[model samples]
Target: MKYTNPVVKGFYPDPSVCSANGKYYMVCSSFQYFPGVPLFESPDLVNWTQIGYVLTRENQVMLDKINSSGGVFAPTIRYNGGRFYMVTTNDTTRQNFYVYTDDIYGEWSDPVYVDQGGIDPSLFFEDGKTYFMSNGLDDEGRSGVIQCEINIETGEKLSKSICIWQGSGGRYLESPHMYKINGSYYLMAAEGGTEYGHMITYARADSVWGEFVGYAGNPVLTNRNKAPYLIQGIGHGDLIRDKNGDWHILCLGFRQIHMWMPYHNLGREVFLIPVKFSADGWFTAGRDGTAEYEYEIKGDFEQKEKKLYTFKNTSWKIDWCHLRRPDFDNYEFYDDSIVLHGSGITLDDADSPAFIALRQRDFEFELSVRLSVDGGEAGVTCYMCEDEHYDIALRKSPEGTEAVLKLNIGGIKHIENTVELSSDSAVLIVRGDNFRYNFYAASQGSEIYLGSGNTKYLTSEVSGGFTGVMLGLYSIGRNSASFSDFSCNYK
Candidate 1:
């Protein structure tokens, strides 16, 4: 059967996968989002479902005053001894920790901090012993892929961290995972940064530590020079063997918005690469180590895609999320609707505001929302961060509510367009394509066009963050508003 690449889409990067009880589970970097470390489940590698998040409670992770790209970095989800463990880095706190739960669907335990430094941490359990590895300096202050024995239950170091392999000559060597395949220890990692030159490399050794040699054809997988191809930055992958005994590498990759346009507002996504292991024990990924838009798997299972939501029910909150830790008392949910009490915060504030949004998954889609603001401003925004976002709001002007379009790029705010209204409520619409979005407002008898704004300006590349564009509902100032009829349709 044929399956799509990026089985998991939108800003979800640095994927790590493992199998338990015949089910495949995956996790990725969440970088400052309130519910940190998005988790997923799959029966086959190509099809995925968002099971939940690894960090829901504030105590499990830190995002207080954290920058857009500063919270949870790459996370690895592993299963051992009937317990599920997730190890990650809080880049903001600059700490590494692991959280575990015996019930996979239940809330995870509070973080068990590890003494190790650096990021992209992973845990490997073998023969009643657990080992931790991260891309940082060892106890001796030597930098490389460092490893140490640890007590899995307490996260206490049982041995001094030691430098392992330096990798096959690439900058920003990270995302290290160890495996014992065919009696040989294989260490895999990504290098060359997480941008255009990103690539995956591996080495093999008789044991977990030391004397690991690079594969003869180092950088076994990379799309760095595969320019004309839309898929780039294919690295930071995890390898897993399926029930059928087939090897597949689930990695992170991003597609340029257009054929030649070099901007991706959807963020780095997850892609599946087919793996082939040689009789001698070396494995190659992709088509000769290159990622593609699709791959033919060994099954005939039909793909069940995630549906575009109209958010007409109580479950809307499941897909909608707030910035930083949510201000629980700011809003209440009823079937198909929400009442948001305006806060002193605005989208311009670098802190959490009265906002709830969903990831902009597709490049071309239409988003519509109906809002009635009692005071201040309320509307939908294509948000990247505090200093970089595009907002279309209904404000209570002296002439009644006004439909206004705001463009904030790199901290410069501009009122691109506005149409004063004589009503208390209005329907705001946003039709977005890969590069820009067209805004419209409809009321009693008049239809107002609020002009268009470029989408590229809100990308991670231009915005200098670790997230993608988010379509959100926001109300600012000290008032309250009712928002309903939210819908998103993909083209």
Candidate 2:
């Protein structure tokens, strides 16, 4: 079967995976989103279903007024001794923590904080001892991938943090994961940032505390210079062995809108690449050390792609996320509909507005929703951050209800188009392609064209954030809005 590059899609960046109990479970970074770490389970590596979130309870993590890419950073999920532990860093608070659960389906326990200063934390268990690792400064103030032995029960440091492997001469050396394979301690980390220059570099040592040796041909996997390719930013990978005992790397990458555009609006997504170990115990990844758009693999199950998503098919708890910490009083959820109570909070601020969103999975999609607003404004938004979003809403004015289209790019806010609606309820539609999104309003069996916005404006390249575009249903300004028949069909 031939599987696509991004087995998981849409804003789910910095992926880490571990196999347990005959199944593969994965976690990804969720910056500034309420449910911090998005968790997914897969029967095979290619097909993944989001099971739940790792940070469900408010007490486990903090996101109040955090910047767009501020909260929960890269998360590493590991399974050991009948328990699952997810270790991550809250970049907003500059603290590292881990949450554990014996039952993966059940709610996770409260966080146990580690007095470590770094992001993208990972835990390794060996010889009845737990070793915590992150990319930061050691006790001697040496900058590199740091390691320390810790008490897993209490997160108390049992040994001084020490620098292990520095890297292979790339900038932003981060996302370090320690693996002991074939009795060799292998440390993998990403470098050259998480952008176009991203690459995965590694080194192996005889002991965990190395004297490590960098691979002669470093950057085991990357698509940095594979220009004019849709897949970009290929780094921050976690190694996994499949049911057939073949090794693969589950990493994060983004699809550019165009080959030469160098702009990506769909956020960093998950990609699976084949890895092979040499006779001397060194490994190389992808096709000739680069990730591809698709790969043919030997698997028992077929690779499937989800093309249509609706309220009935998607789980509200697993598929939907809101900005920062949301006020529960602002939202009312039903089986087929959602009612949002608009508050004074708006999308322009860092505060949590009445917004619930799903990640935009692909470049071509048609999003439509039937919305009815009683007083203020409610609509569907293509949201990237506080400053970058496109909204098509039904607002109540003194004259009547009007359909409004707004494009917000950085400091510029423009109402591109509007239509006088005959009724309070209308279907808002947003049709998107690789280049742009077109807005429309439908009422009385007629579709009115609102306007369009360029997709480049909403990309992380232009928006300057670590997230991708989200299709959000939102309301604002002390009103009651009911949304129904919402669907996003991707082609």
What TM-score against the true fold does each predicted structure earn? 0.98, 0.99
lDDT of model 2, residue 463: 94
| All models, RMSD in angstroms | 1.3, 0.7
Q: Write the per-residue lDDT of candidate 2 for residues 303-339, one digit (tens) a residue.
A: 8889988998988899999999999899999988999
The whole-model C-alpha lDDT of candidate 1 against the native structure comes to 0.87
What TM-score number comes out for model 1? 0.98
Which number leads on lDDT? 2
Backbone clash count for every predicted candidate, in the order shown: 0, 0
Give candidate 1 regions above 4 Å deviation: 313-317
Model 1, range 146-208, lDDT digits (tens) per residue?
A: 999999879999999999999998999999999999999999999998888999999999998
Model 1: per-residue Cα lDDT at residue 45: 83
- Candidate 2: which stretches are off by over 4 Å? none
* lDDT (0 to 1) per candidate: 0.87, 0.93
